[model samples]
Target: MAKNKDVRVTVILECTSCVRNGVNKESTGISRYISQKNRHNTSSRLELKKFCPYCYKHTVHGEIKK
Candidate 1:
């Protein structure tokens, strides 16, 4: 496991296209890919999620700057 303290929010992807429009940005074609890609250095981990749009939900992803 990793420390959540270093974990901070980085982005919020609008997941309307996945469930509602049936689109895929990446991953298993999940609702959203919220990320810490903008973070300094870490790992890409999924932190939070919500029901996809249509289901009106989204997913949170974390990115480690490398």
Candidate 2:
């Protein structure tokens, strides 16, 4: 069980543009991504540049609390 905590964890990334600009209101849902990151290597929240289908552009996707 202790070893599991040290492994990469699954995280959800949400589009910053869609949330800040209220673009999700028009669409059925907001853009989200599932990824894994090393807990030991990346102590801080992860952010990545990803494509937002609703926004129709690439935007910064930040980690959200599960």
Candidate 3:
């Protein structure tokens, strides 16, 4: 059987701008995205530019602990 650990793991990406500002103009919550990354490939935290509906713009999204 496969072990608990896997090569690819699920991760949550949160908007940094919204987190720092602590407010969302369009909505009442911060924007978040679900994504997956290879654990072996990315040893460090992942950051990506994604569209935030609450902010209504593209912002830097960083990986957060589950």
Candidate 4:
């Protein structure tokens, strides 16, 4: 018998359904600032939890690769 192991590096995200309540105009600036911060400093994925302004809830999902 062998132990099962699972590891992941990256996965597709559905960020269109996140509930954005506390987000403000300043967030827009912050997002832009972050992009500029990573322009040449590093190669990291700036994963954002964008909330859906319409649905008023966070509905984003994550799936494991097979």
Write the number of the candidate with greater lDDT, choosing between 3 and 4. Answer: 3
**Cα lDDT tens digits for candidate 4, 34-59:** 11223244345445554444444444
Candidate number achieving the greatest lDDT relative to the actual structure = 3
Q: In candidate 3, what are the lDDT values of residues 1-66, reduced to their tens digit?
A: 876988999999999999999776558899899999999999999999999989889999999999
Better of 3 and 4 by TM-score: 3
Return the clash pairs for model 4, or none.
18-51, 18-52, 19-51, 19-57, 19-58, 20-51
Q: What tens-digit string does per-residue lDDT give for candidate 1 at 4-61?
A: 8543556655454454546644445545445454345634443455555444344533
Give, for candidate 2, the lowest lDDT window spanning 10 residues. 1-10
The sequence of per-residue lDDT tens digits that candidate 2 reaches over residues 1-66 is: 345454679999999988898776668778999999999899899999999999888999999999
Candidate ranking under TM-score, highest first, comes to 3, 2, 1, 4
RMSD of 1: 9.8
Estimate every model's Cα lDDT from 0 to 1: 0.47, 0.90, 0.94, 0.36
For candidate 1, list the clashing residue pairs, or say none: 34-61, 36-63, 51-57, 52-56, 52-57, 53-56, 53-57
lDDT of 3 at 38: 99
Candidate 2 vs 3: which has more lDDT: 3
TM-scores of all predicted structures:
0.25, 0.86, 0.89, 0.25
